[model samples]
Target chain A: MATHGKKQDNRSPADWWLFVLGFVLFAAVGFWATPAILYAEKPQPFQFSHKLHMEQVGEGCQSCHAFREDGSYTGIPSLEKCKECHGEEPMGETPEEKVFSKDYVAKNKPIPWQVYSKQPPCVFFSHAAHVANAGLECASCHGDHGDTEKLRTYEYNRLTGYSRDIWGWSLIPLDGPPKRMKMDDCAKCHRDNGVRDACFVCHK
Target chain B: MSSSASEMRFGMVIDVDKCTGCGACSVACMSENNVGVLPDETDKIRSITWLRVYQIDNGQPYPNTQIAFFPRPCQHCAGSQGHHTPCVSVCPATATDRDPKTGIVSQIPTRCIGCRYCVAACPYHARYFNWYDVPWPEGMDKPLSPFVAPRMRGVVEKCTFCFHRYQRAQNKAFTSGEAMGEMDYQTACTEACPSGAITFGDLNNPEHKVHELKKSPYAFRLLERLHTDTAVYYVSAREWVRRQADNYLSGEKLAKVQAGGGH
Candidate 1:
């Protein structure tokens, strides 16, 4: 009823029920939006300055992850590969290096550095296609790891094996358009670029 | 000037009649291809043997028994009148390709991710996988042929029809401006045989030894009904040794093959 016409005084019971339903929907979304922690995401073991490594140190990604002659990639540097440069312990001259050497590599045990960039074999993620072909920057998927000295830990859901903050999109990327890697985002990119997008090409 | 344009199909002829099952072919093939050995070769099922020499029993008693050694390799089939050979059709990567020029099946290990699909597809059991990283005692790597690349930990490898020899032949042909004639590329097993039991050349090439040998009265292919159109053909004067090549339902397959090579 219009107020200018002055037709009706009381609203219907159905309108009140509808109001309740809308309120309930809103509350449920807010609740789901709350951050759910997976594995207690923590800072990396030690602060690694990629800026010092890349721009100042003049080292590249291939320095750590070596490529095979057959075009397949293998991450993680071998102990012997590292000893080639640091045999006399040149890098370990610093306090941080001393700590890394004393705790991790001195005893022949390799560092179990956690990598967020790694994906499962079931999901085919090729750095070659993305970086070499599409001309995408490293910062696109990795976010801003170069700027930051220390790696931060976020809670990861064990069952799903994804970060809890990303799962709900509350703690991380709260203000961004769509948080977490969704299939639709990939589909949109593929559709824009006129690629075959065959299931076996990526999925298999 | 046009050497093999008359007829060209690369093939092999094995004389089981002369074969003593001496296992020289197996040793020669392994040494030539750089096939690795396992400590536990006791389990022949899982072990990698590109050329497995089977010792067939005649099932006779009272000194009437006979035995023969049959050395098998990658069939390099032309298919049934050029249909689908089992291993070639199933490979997803398109790594292996049948040479249209020579009719030889080639193995591309660099492309193989050790999926092991081709391993199961072969009924003759030709393909092998590198389960462990290849290791040499101390000084053996230098002796390996530079033409044959040592395979890494993860991949499938098979007989290459001694492709290095073909490359050498082609190199010679290119330099001399002469064609790569038949018998120019022979397998190591063929050359290593003391009794000259093995013949290697193109089956399609009429001038080649293999082509003429394939038309022999006793010439027959392994698993002909399966229709691999295998480049490797066997000649046996005996009936029972011929029967051992493939599975037959009574007189069905034998009758067909016998009719042709029977004379």
Candidate 2:
């Protein structure tokens, strides 16, 4: 019985290290969790009226970002893609139509169109990889932009090419199932979702 | 393509004794890979070549002068059981990979955003960057091999060991429902060399001629001590030509290796 007590007391140093690691993980969750929870889940930039665009005009996401033959996707509609359809002033009624024809089409520049969900460069955020592989909704990462009624005005960090809000905070829960689009955020999702990768597999 | 580790150290062995300095292999590699040509390709570094023949000469004047041409390409290291390969270790993007199946180092050009770290990591300088976009004179894009896409400007390119051929061969096997056979793949340079200097086959297969040639007494890898585990081996009777491929420090361990090991 005395020997059994001694054996019970003699836990391996590995056990101690694992305990320390668990405590560290808990602390990290606590520290990071607070900021993410508190941030305002502000409405998206530009009042992008998706119902007006998708429902009334009968356009799809592909109407903007053209699909490639090889299953890759390309840029949102360039000024030319818009000009191809919208004429030099005909059947225009709403303020939105005026903004599209007069401001964007009249000027030869592609709409300094702010891409709402611009994932950073170091990561390969293949919409194909996720959509085809995991069966995830677009709203899973990009918040409910499709439901909104106005153009989402883009907020920028500029230097990092990250959204100003994403650089700091989001109402998205960091502790729950992966909600954000950081590399580690995606890595966590991959781990939970049974997708695996090396650092180079996604980093570059 | 994969087999047990003992039977799967994929490699290449080059016979320098049989080689002539004709640039046939280089020309074939460029055309086969669809490597873009700049109007100013006179500069070699900025130029793309999957197989490049380098001229090496015994630095003696007149009658004593001896010249041999050596071709440089990716070594495709076996990588120390599971450790560092010069290019494979440092790649920030998983653009390059040593296939465990065949031991071929595969390059994914689309994944490579011209980070040139792999270019600099290779001791042989095999990888090339597309500085200028591929400009096919009007109405010539259809002639391109449907298997290989011509690379755009700003991507790193290299010898795929003619992986498109391997893929086609694999596809044929898949449709026929037969296993991929030994003679299934041969790099364009190997077939194009007039002198038959380059031999391409899976080193892992004992029945393959490449496997037997690998055991020759004359066979040696480039920079073996740097531990790159280079697949390419050169067999040269000329000591100067063999020595020119890699640098040896003054009275270094390789001097001892040559004295004691009899390689």
DockQ scores for all the models shown? 0.02, 0.03
Off by over 4 Å in 1: A1-204, B1-7, B251-253, B257-263
Off by over 4 Å in 2: A1-204, B1-10, B250-255, B258-263
Interface RMSD of each: 14.2, 9.1
TM-score of chain A of 2: 0.64
Cα lDDT tens digits for candidate 1, A1-204: 555664354678888899999999999886765443234464455556665665543456656555443333455566666566554353735576675666666776676666554443324445545654466665665566665665556445566665443333444333321244443445556777765333323331
Error of 1 at A49 (Å): 43
lDDT values of the candidates? 0.66, 0.65
lDDT (tens digit, per residue) of candidate 2 on B39-94: 88798878888888888898999899998888876777766646666677677887
Best by DockQ: 2
TM-scores, one per candidate: 0.55, 0.55
Q: What lDDT score is found at residue A104 in candidate 2?
A: 61
Candidate that would win on TM-score: 2
Clashes of each: 11, 12
